[model samples]
Target: MNENLFRPQFDALKLSDKLWLMQTLATRYHLTFKELYAFSRWGQSCTTGLFEKGGREFVFVPGNTVILGWEGFVQGMDKANQEELADIFAEIEYEGSVEGFLRQGMTPVRQVTIGPMFVGRKLEEIGWESVPMNDPRITAHPDWLDALRKLADRDGQSLKIHETVRFERNGDSWKAWLCHPMTYPEFQRSLLWDLAASLPTPDEWAYLCGGGCRTLFPWGDGMDYSMHLHHFESPEDEDKPFDMEEPNFFGVSIAYDPYMREVVKAEQFTTCGGDGGRGICGGLGIFLGFLPCSPHCKPKVQEDKELNGDYDFYRPIIRLENHD
Candidate 1:
């Protein structure tokens, strides 16, 4: 939120008024415009009548700091450039809306593209409904298994036996983890803020593992053992799952670990980018010269009963509408 005091009024706008102030600050920060059109001038071609309607793309982190396009794959801009690019966006001084800047906590950052559509299979084709909860084929109907066996007999050993369970469908209702015996970082950060209408902070996981390029790993500083990594060349490959490798410029594959994802800022909980080592659960580790997979490592700082298991996974960040 400290975008260097609005960088000289966003470097004195003009590129079509800075693309209409980045489509009016990405719809005042709820962000979801999949395509904004009108570029051309040397940037090749692209002209779809300057915004008529187009939602569900989510990743325009203009001033909440870096991760807009390109690395996330050409999200439009140019339109003949009138000037202004002073460090890519930062002027909208919070006038209201976007749920009042997410009730003052403010957040918007996305970028992790590289290849083989990874961030957990593009958060499962943009609907994110995992719920492996330790597998056993994941059944749940005898009245939700007798209400989870009376919530594991009224929370005995602090529940979370094995844990995995992810959800987020929203049409016929299937949102986050309905509570019951769910605990840890407050019901998995309130079931990932009710299954991703937004919730991926920790500075958007440090701008998607350093896309601002301070380098340590985000495709730099060397260490490309031929791409598709995993336990540094095979530490007894545990069946290797998750996006099968090759992604980083923001498509975000198994970024380096066997599991360790759970990110959020104001409501607390923290852990970021790095997996496939704590005994490999779902392979594909994006090499970063080893050691807690760089990009500023961050191995500890988890407490809400240590979030849960299967490497504590989590990934969802939608916002095509529904500000609830």
Candidate 2:
């Protein structure tokens, strides 16, 4: 019985066309009838802010973008929308608690605020620093020390430096090691789950890097070797730290680096990015070394293997509300 006759012609229609079609549908059928039909097609999930289609659950991310699939949320976000979301993130107060780590100096914990279609990067990698015995950030609480000791023991390592503090810092920072891909997920479950924050997925990282760009680097298709900083230059040359480099379209810093960022996919495989050192200017040089820093690049790493090096670091994502 040719059901095609009953189906609405929605394909090939623009957004305006779709709206016009809806208006026509509503007029031909009673408004109530059209409403019922629309609800039957998209209501359940739409009302719940979740859409299940194509075997994937489309979750509503805060701001104008919706996470349609794992590929990249920015694909659904136009430049204006992305900028608007970034503005929202820029205005959001840091409601989360700050954990101060005492090293040579007190390093207050800081996190970059990013929401759907927005982006962020850590000022520096997480590292351990030595602090004075009397540093105010030092906590001698027996329970805290016990917990630290237990964590070290579980890692089969002995705890050193009674006054040691962990922190995220720039300049001479140490790498996070002996941690598997699940490490960040477990940490989120233990600490940040309540805050509605978690480690970023691979897709999130890629989006943060490229936004909608398919370029060799996030900023553009070309990389001027003159802009290369910190790695290849002489000591007398100005030190242009990657973090201080101009931000990408989404205000994310340090899109490419000799160091690798540890990331996870579906909480299963360990992957790394930004490790490829340097390459020629364009996509043609991707195979040389630029591929590691390419937005879509996902260097494979064994899930079970603990990435024990200074190169591996993780970033966190804070989930924002769709409404205030």
Question: What are the models' TM-scores?
Answer: 0.27, 0.43
Error of 1 at 303 (Å): 30
On residues 89-146, what C-alpha lDDT tens digit does candidate 1 reach at each position?
Answer: 1243434432232223212334542211012213212212445444344454344444
Error of 2 at 30 (Å): 45
Which portions of model 1 miss their true places by more than 4 Å?
1-16, 19-21, 24-57, 61-140, 150-152, 156-207, 212-258, 261-272, 276-293, 296-324
The TM-score leader among the candidates is 2
Q: 141-198 in candidate 2: lDDT tens per residue?
A: 4654565556654553333332233422223332221212235445446335433335
* Residue 45 in candidate 1, Cα distance off native in Å: 29
Report model 1's TM-score to 2 decimal places.
Answer: 0.27
> Ten residues in a row with the worst lDDT in model 2?
39-48
